[model samples]
Target: MTVDESDAYVLRDELPDPETFAHLREVAGMGPRSLEAIERGLPNTIYGVIAVHEPSGEVIGMGRLVGDGGAVYQISDMAVHPDHQGKGLGTGIMDRLEAHLEAEAPAGAYVNLVADVDDFYERFGYEPVRPGSKGMHRRIE
Candidate 1:
């Protein structure tokens, strides 16, 4: 019920198990994150897309949308396993996330994301917020 048929890979509209989520992020070069954060944050995802390698049933890619549904939303934790690069899985994930946002977010809702590469996100109508606003964040130890 979670995965679609006809392929060695599939996308599921659900959160990956925490272990898979963390593992994919690391293998995808996103760096390791606190397990505590993963546990605390995943449940709050307004939507999550996970790519599974059907042969292994391994979650090899993921992306999440988080924030207040009516006003603020962000596309976060996007990553694909290194072995799965150049296969358009990222695009597939983003397409899913964007569709969900388009359907669920309010007309004026502000959607944002911290993009590692601008060009990839540009294809999705996301542009730099520069000249108006900049992204800032702080780490909590």
Candidate 2:
């Protein structure tokens, strides 16, 4: 049965528990993350938000911000369970994250995220940094 999101959903200022976090990532096809890293890192989150199915108490979506307490921050681990996509859960997560950034991140701080879907991030005022600059990453062995 399709849940009528207007009333049966909740956005909470909380991180998903490790298992739920991992499961959401998998279901969203975001690939795998180190469980050990997640265990160590989640507690240090600057701010995070989770969407839940109120009746089931299940995490349906989540997003988080992490970085040095002062200047730079990155939005990471944004995902929604496959069954729960297209219902504005991702937007709800971004709304909370944006509020936290507005409230806490200092002026001139750089906020960035790697986007699998540019259209989604673009809606939040993010633009590609191509000709003038670029994004680079190195995975640790």
Which candidate number has the best lDDT?
A: 2
What does candidate 2's lDDT look like per residue over 37-98, in tens digits? 78988999999999998878888999999999678999999998888788899999999999
Task: Give the least accurate 10-residue stretch of model 2, judged by summed lDDT.
Answer: 1-10
Q: Scored by Cα lDDT, where does model 2 land?
A: 0.89
Number of the predicted model whose TM-score against the real structure is largest: 2
Give, for candidate 1, the lowest lDDT window spanning 10 residues: 1-10
Look at candidate 2 and tell me the lDDT of residue 46. Answer: 93
lDDT of 1 by residue, 23-140 (tens): 8888877768888989988999899999998887878899999998889999999999888778799999999999998888888999999988658999999999998997898877
Clashing pairs counted in every model = 0, 0
Q: Candidate 1's error at 130, in angstroms? A: 0.5
- What is each predicted model's overall lDDT from 0 to 1? 0.88, 0.89
